[model samples]
Target: MPTFADPFQQHQAEQLLQPVLIRVVDNLRKAMEASNWIGTYEEHLLWPEGTTTAEQEQVRQIAAQLEDADPEAAQHLQEQLSHLPMPFPGYELRLSQGEHTQRIDVWNLCYQVCFTHYDPDTPAEVDPHLLDEVGDVDWLALDEKAQQLVQVAFEQLGEGRKD
Candidate 1:
């Protein structure tokens, strides 16, 4: 089994995953702004009466700020968000790794979204030598994991608008 030179490696991985989590939240906020509720029930649950214009505008403003700060990342985040089903308000993505365990938690204000675990001791499919050659973490692998988390979030939330 491969061992990280320092425990901080786990912290580094969490740092890498932060942007992905932020993007996920931004995407959900955008969806809410658009009145693109995941399902009829979700729609009703989130806004039992109806969404106020002020609420919609608030979400829009937050998105605008994020876009203005980094348009490229915003665009990429939008593209990824488009693929996901609608999410509830206040959704959160949490990730952490320990000596032998890696875990992800996706949830919203009201309930749990999805939970995943991985054994860090297990060898990955990618060649170990390649990692050494790069002298950098495999970000693509983390991105894929992030995408999977979003997919699982959507699935756990249930169906949304077809379009």
Candidate 2:
């Protein structure tokens, strides 16, 4: 397992955060689609360094205390808790919106998973260049999990699979 000390600082962080975020988003997407609800998916996540200086200082104090008392345990605790903020300010929400005049709220389930700390106001129009990047997203393709969900739903409905 890669730790923060490795050359993979950002990479490790993304590895953990991205999948978790994606799963949360996917659950929201599935729920919304199932209920025939529509909307953008918004995620409010914590950002490091977006905190106040006083809060950082408080964290540093706690870390120092732990380090002096028990260096080994302190290191482990610090590594695990490093991503967390001392005062824990709050999260910033990001919502997904469609192009043109169409805008949709995230699926109800998505909201459950994402759990916005605060309301997400309308976001600026997405960059057109982002669309080009869309094709590179392999996860967007229908996978076995999605196919299985559809299959089960159809079976439960007493309907045969469609050709």
What would the per-residue lDDT of candidate 2 be over residues 84-106, giving only the tens digit for each residue? 57442233222222331223232
Cα error, candidate 1, residue 135 (Å): 5.1
Please give, for residues 41-73, the per-residue lDDT of candidate 1 as tens digits. 122223213556665555555556666667777
Instruction: Give the Cα error of residue 106 in candidate 1, in Å.
Output: 5.0
Q: Which ten residues in a row have the lowest lDDT in candidate 2?
A: 122-131
Candidate with best TM-score: 1
Show model 2 residue runs off by greater than 4 Å.
Answer: 1-14, 42-163
Backbone clashes in model 2, listed as residue pairs: 28-110, 39-104, 39-105, 40-104
Candidate 1: which stretches are off by over 4 Å? 1-6, 26-35, 38-137
* Model 2, position 80: C-alpha lDDT score: 51
